[model samples]
Target chain A: MDILLALVVAVLLVVGGLFALLAAIGIVRLPDVYTRMHAASKAGTVGSSLMLVAAGLHSGEFATFARAFAGVVFFILTAPVAAHLVAKAAHQAGYRLSRGAVCDDMRDKAKN
Target chain B: MPSAEEKRQRTGLVLPTGFAGLWLLLFCLWLIFNSSLALPILATGVVAATALAWIFTTRSTVWHYVRLTPRTLYHFLAYTGVFFVELVKANVNMLRYVYSPRIDIRPGIVKIRMRLRSPIGRLALANSIALTPGSLVMDVEDDALYVHWLDVRTTDIDEASEMIAGPFEKHLGRVFG
Candidate 1:
């Protein structure tokens, strides 16, 4: 059982690390600032949340698990708000999409 | 300096009625692990966690939105799991792309017409694309996504659009819509 637990924790950590690595790559490879921000938000929140869960498991104590889970909840709640702020700010600052792109509701909103 | 109900709410005794149960669990674990009287430690942990949750929830109207069903909850977990796997695969692919001796990066912007309506769903789609190895969500205007690819694998815009949107949009819709 202890070995099984260790294996689970290891898998979690590796997966979390992979998510973090992908987020960094996205920051570099993505086309626009807003898109990059999206990568950062989801990957950062979920990646760290996974890491925290693993830490809780490794500790094998109830308090640690509770605190870690609480932290994940906090992160999930905050990340989207931050992403919205970034996207809204970018739009307000006059970033344009590619020409072939179809449908733009924000532009319609601003037209009125 | 307050009525009973007000005081209870202020102390967070009204909601999280299972608060004490979680605290008791923590206390027992502390005693078992560290071999000590963990009442004080358990009290501290409960207070801190509750306060943190309260503070986080209070900052935005988003948190006050209606609760999610269990079906939605499972979808969310499954999506995140799939997302993690994609992230890892992307990272490995990115490394290979960056180190290739003869760089063949045909970078260009591609626009994808999207169908997701929920702000959360739209955001998830954009973020998921951005989280992939070579794609970025540069701009989103309503149902359209303007993406920047570090290396364009195809000149056909529709092909690129479908390639990027395939599983991500489907799963995000399930989770957020």
Candidate 2:
């Protein structure tokens, strides 16, 4: 049972670490600010949450679970708010989506 | 000018009382979980948790509604379960690509509209998008969400919307709306 628990922890940690790395690469390599934000927000939120869960599993205690649960809740609540704020700021600064993009709602608003 | 009763309702919860209540709750929780709390320490813990919960929960007028219902409880559980599964899957996939030497990645931004109307729903949607792998939400305006993607696996906006909007917005609509 302990071995099984350890295996689970190892898997979670490895997976969480990998996602964090993906998020970083996406942030660095993505062509534009908008794209980079996408990478960071999606990858980062999931990565951190997984890491928290892994920590909780490894600890295998109620207190650890509660703390990890709190972290997960906080991550869920804050990540999107931060992303929305960033995107809103970027859009206000006149960051245009790539051309040949089929629909342009923000552009249309500018026309009106 | 204000009536005494109105004032009583408004300022009824003084700081000390509030903190004491919070501390009490925490002490109780500690006792329940830890299975041992001496009287003096329990008193101290009670005072602390109550104070903290009061200060923490009362931080913003943004949280206007406090009512809970069966539907809301259901929504909460559903949201947690879905988010947990997605979080695990995204983490595993992200690790694989990141560790790979070739680093096969295609990145871009996609703008899409959200169906959620309430501030809470919009917030939840944005957060969920950010939480998922391969996507990040950069902005939300009215009904729209501007997202950045680590990979443009498909250009179909509908598909992307389905991936995002289905689980989260449905629950948000139930909770906030």
| RMSD, one per candidate, in order | 8.7, 5.8
Distance (Å) between predicted and true CA of A38, model 1? 11
Question: Which interface RMSD does candidate 2 score?
Answer: 4.7
Q: Which lDDT tens digits does candidate 2 get at residues B25-64?
A: 4666666554455787777666667666677546743233
Backbone collision count in every prediction? 1, 13
Interface RMSD of 1: 7.6
**Tens digits of lDDT, candidate 1, B34-128:** 44456886666667656655554444333332235687667777778777677666555565653445534545556677767676577677766
lDDT of 1 at B160: 73
TM-scores across all candidates?
0.51, 0.67
Error of 1 at B139 (Å): 1.1
Error of 1 at B63 (Å): 7.8
DockQ of each: 0.12, 0.31
Cα lDDT of model 2 by residue, A1-112, tens digit: 9999999988988877877788899777655666556566667776788899999888888777777867777777787677667766887788875442334445555688
